[model samples]
Target: MGEHVRAGNLDIWTEQVGRGPEVLLVGGLGDTVESWQFQLDGLADRYRLIAFDNRGAGRTPMPDGPVSVEVMADDAAALLGVLGLAPVHVAGFSGGSIISQELALRHPGLVRSLVLQSTWPVMDPYLRSWARFVRRLVEFAPSERAFLEDFFLDIYTARAHNDGTVDQFIEEVLAFPHKQAPRDTQRFLDAFIDHDTTDRLPGITAPTLVLAGGLDPTARPELCRSVADRIPGARFEILEGEAHQPFQEIPETWNSRVDAFWRELAPVT
Candidate 1:
């Protein structure tokens, strides 16, 4: 269901599914097209969904020199242009949201609308400190499992933890091949930490929706709201009792909410 597509300078690994209006899903740091399995399955009936592995993640190879959000945004632009899927709806999660912001700014013609989930406009002191700790943990963790266990703490809600969802995630990740190397993970984190789009939000011409989890520790509702406030006519919504990854924990609800937003813009026939 996936193929290697020549986009930009890399042979980007991409997956496409379903039919109808095109929708592109962008994942966070260290994520791949597999990260949106739930969406690919749940939303495909109504959307022509596309997902891809970012540079240095999964099947995509890292290019020489450094990577930045702008570079990654350009990559997305190239992918869409190459596929002739321009003016498509774009949804970005966490670090992907940052890249999406840059994409909307740098290549506005490629984007029809934007959905930013678990997004932040700037890396504040709190997030900076947490990112620093994460870098240290990545550098020092004894094993991959150990690192993921600690990393999932900030990503999922208490309910997910209590209901064994986090465990399931760990099991799947451990079983999946093409694990992101530590160096690549650090490189992605470095790009995420250095990104800032505070003054540039107003430049994005795409209609935008910003969603945040009420219980998310990393991209808190308050911070996410600030992003919504900055963008003209962007809607902000909070999924109560959810954490950073509601799309995985509650795919049906997440998909329905997103579907409704898109429908409001262009009614489904």
Candidate 2:
């Protein structure tokens, strides 16, 4: 329910809750730690949960000018260090997944396990093109409606939209502290634009879980499955009737799967 220590040169605004094996959550750009709101409360009793705003986003102050994803990953590790917890379980969504990958790559000893959702090792050709297409909405269609429509069209399965809960979603997004900061937006997008870490997927040391929405054009199940195939002992789960934001789009299914993922690896201590 409060903030954690500053990591390196960054303040690293974060929310830490619960009291078991530490789990750190990272979110996409323009997404605050609060994006995890719906998932945290239920998991709090069993896990020591920490969610934070990445550098250049939300309350985490950017380092003057532009920053790279590598730096962002470092910030995440530093946050963990400050909490006196080493070897954490990590879960990242969208750009957050890239940050987790970078952390696992640079500091393999610090990660006990990994969960990647709605994200690929890097942007595939189609996703790269799609990102470029959506980037246009920043200017041409600045309104939330336009972006929401594009997001729904590009990411969600038809079944996800069947019940009509978008208004609730709109309010949640609006309530977040990260309401459309262009600098953070551009920096975040640029990091994924030409990056391709598929070659390095095999280097990850943690037991991995790759979660992808079946209908998400950006992080298709096939791409995430490919990521899982590369990592030793990694598992892939392709959820039907979901969107890019599956944790929020369908939390019960997400909560159940995530709870199981952790329980399966519950330490023998």
Candidate 3:
């Protein structure tokens, strides 16, 4: 079950499961706790996982005025402090990864380790254009289903589309009760496009693992590599045959890889 917890100025909706080392799972733009469903189910047997809806997404209400990456990172930090879960393993995907980078830089003592998936250190022209296009779709797309159908093309591979995986995902999103408003979605995308942590990533002290998808168009391997290159001792790998969200597309493989990385840091006794 999920409940709203008082974190900072907002009541952040969070869900937790399992019992072991604590792990925080952060999702991408317009995502909620439900986004980490695969991880919650796959890794819960051996680890305690906490997943939350980012501000301006899901059941979480957006605060007044604009939201930035730093603000969102601070929200995560505050949540940890309130929950007494500091120094926990943190895993972030896509836009969530950008927020994770800021969190590590701002609250080094709160993060034990970081697993950044489909991340980038800076938004290049290609990425900026892509962000803008996504925002435009949010503003002008004919309908929610239409927007998702068009947007999934960049995130999923041809195999997923051909095999009806993307179709099922779209249906799930449609069925979900707490849908993100188009304006809020645009705001989240805007924040992502404005963020740049190129020089600051080196300041992160947490053990970090950066993973990219071989077939991802949004955050390509080169962009993801730049993030690892800047962070000292951070390992980078590409999940071959995967697209932007291998966690959803190939949950078994994704869960195993992330679990292995975490286990290496704090081996079972």
lDDT of 3 by residue, 117-159 (tens): 9999988999899999999999888999999999999999999
Task: Residues 105-167, candidate 1: write the lDDT tens digits.
Answer: 999998999999999999888987888888889889998899999999999988888899899
Candidate 2 Cα lDDT to native: 0.80
Query: Which of candidates 2 and 3 is the stronger one according to lDDT?
Result: 3
Model 3: how far is 44 from its true place, Å?
A: 0.6
Instruction: Compare the candidates by lDDT and give the number of the best one.
Output: 3
Q: lDDT of all predictions, in order shown? A: 0.92, 0.80, 0.93
For model 2 the TM-score comes to 0.92
Query: Which residue pairs does candidate 1 place in steric collision?
Result: none
Q: Candidate 1 — what's its lDDT?
A: 0.92
The better-scoring model by TM-score among 2 and 3 is 3
TM-scores for all candidates?
0.99, 0.92, 0.99
* Candidates arranged by lDDT, highest first: 3, 1, 2
Evaluate candidate 3 by giving its C-alpha RMSD to the native, one decimal.
Answer: 0.8
